[model samples]
Target: MNGRLIAIGDIHGCHQEFADLLQLIKLEPGDQLILLGDLVNRGPDSHRVVELARQHGAIALLGNHERRLLAARRNPDKVKVRDSEKATYSQLDDADWAYLNAMPLTHEVPELNMVFVHGGFLPDRSWREQGADIVTEVQVIDRDGRPCKRREAPEALPWADHWTGPPFVVYGHTPRDDVYKLKWSLCLDTACAMGGQLTAFILPERRLVQVKARRRYYP
Candidate 1:
């Protein structure tokens, strides 16, 4: 039998909550944990979060925030630092950086029948043909295969309703008040950075596990 695939939502550096969630899960050797990105910034202990993910051999994909970190570091001058990101930046060493760098932009797990990514996938394009921007930035999807930036858009439909394959396009990056679960896709980023709950989606079982943050780490 295959191990259960547990898709964890955006951690946002709340290592304590992350750890608590793991404990709640009582992870077995036959369980596979997949971190859906946004592991750093906006909370305390980004280092610990990343390290824990590494030690567990979890599949931690790259998130928009991680991309921002790289972009900010690339710039010689600091324009604007985001919330608690300063701690995340200052604490990471070269190995941690490499580990983050080594993580894939997306993970295609055939066993789980899900395409995991930081952001929504392009509805009209093949996975490989998807542009970098679309793979990492889209929030909502309309009927015509176009991205809807706002849910209030007149033409907006669920991002997954129109999509096909893998049965699930599991993604993060877009934080919401509730877990985004549509016919074909799901968004697990429940705003852990804003002191919301850190969520996890258990595959096959189709169960949701969440642990509330101790306090608001970022405003």
Candidate 2:
């Protein structure tokens, strides 16, 4: 039998909750753990979160947080930094940096017709053709038919709302009170850093597994 494809939502440095979720999952050797991204920042122990991911050989996608950190590291003078981001920056060592640096923008499972991404894709264009800015930060589609963050265009519809897919997108970035499960896409960033669940989507089965957050780690 083929191995299972398991995708987890944004972790955001909630190490204890992530660790607990892992224990609950009981990952087998054949199972592929695809971390949907935001593996660092906004919570305690970003280093340990990366350590666990590396130890488990998880395929971590590049979320906006990771992208921001990389940009800041590459151009410290150009990119503005937040205190939370600075904390995560200080926590990560060379290996962690390497891991973040090596993260891909997307992962595809052709057999399942699934595409795993950190954020989501614009429905109007080819998902494969989209750049990092769209796939790592977009949450909504503005009236002008452009990808944007929700805060940038409050009245805009979610990008997933417009998506019609064969390669169904599974992503994390826009944290919500619950998993946003649409017909074509699924949003799994269940606000773990803000006292929600750490969700996991098990593929081939399309099953959901989640663990409650220990507490609100960020404001």
Candidate 3:
């Protein structure tokens, strides 16, 4: 029983929607599930979402939210955010934080000539080059209204149609009202946490499937 290859967008803690989307796709035990990243934060049940991914043997990538959680854990004084965002971080336990930190930033499947990244990849660079070492530099807006750069690839490598590295690059982070499918990349983040739907792509077939959340799962 050969299973299909399914890649999901950022879940953002929308557990119910994620579960429903899986059922809609009829994900079987043999199926391979890959998550593009942002599995936690901004939505309800971030912990549950991560656990679900683990239970199903899914390959979950790291996203910016996860990095934020790590930063908050490391330097609580450095953490400054809205009440909602702060609460989300406060909910994370040591074990949950470890899980998020342990996730890989990108995953490559040579057979499909596809790479899964959380945001997008930098233009004109291979995934290997972009994700060479574990530590990465990420750009973020700081409290001083200045652009602060942090270590950790916050999102997928920025990509465009000019890319020729691989046939397909699946990623999340920037959720579109509609899934954006370009010749070389696919943006599956539906912003489920923001009252959108949870989306998944069936590889090889390039079929898109989604399940709308019952409510806004995130702030």
**How does each model score on lDDT?**
0.81, 0.92, 0.73
Candidate 2: Cα lDDT at 161? 91
> If scored against the real structure, what TM-score would every candidate get?
0.86, 0.97, 0.80
Whole-model lDDT for model 1 versus the true structure?
Answer: 0.81
Candidate 3 segments whose C-alpha is farther than 4 A from its true place:
80-82, 131-158
Candidate 2 steric clashes: 0
Task: Encode model 3's per-residue lDDT on 1-219: one tens digit a residue.
Answer: 268889998898888988999899998877999888788877888878877887788878878777766777778788765465675676666666677778888888888888887765555444576651221222333333222243333432334333555647777777767787778877787879889889999976879998987888656
Which ten contiguous residues of candidate 1 have the minimum total lDDT?
150-159
Model 1 Cα displacement at 61 (Å)? Answer: 0.5
lDDT of candidate 2 over 1-219, digit per residue (tens): 267888999999999998999889888888889999999998898899999999989999999999999999999999977776888999999999999999999999888888999999988878999999989989999999888889999999999999999789999999998899988899999999999999999988999999999999998
Tens-digit lDDT string for candidate 1 (1-219)? 377889998998899999999999888888888888889888889999999988888988888777778777777386455755788888888867887887777888777677888877766667766654676667768666676565546567655556776547888877888798877888898888798999999978989999988988888
Which candidate gets the maximum lDDT versus the true structure? 2
Rate residue 40 of model 3 by lDDT: 80
Which has the better TM-score: candidate 2, or candidate 3?
2
- Mark the 10 consecutive residues where model 2 has the least summed lDDT: 1-10
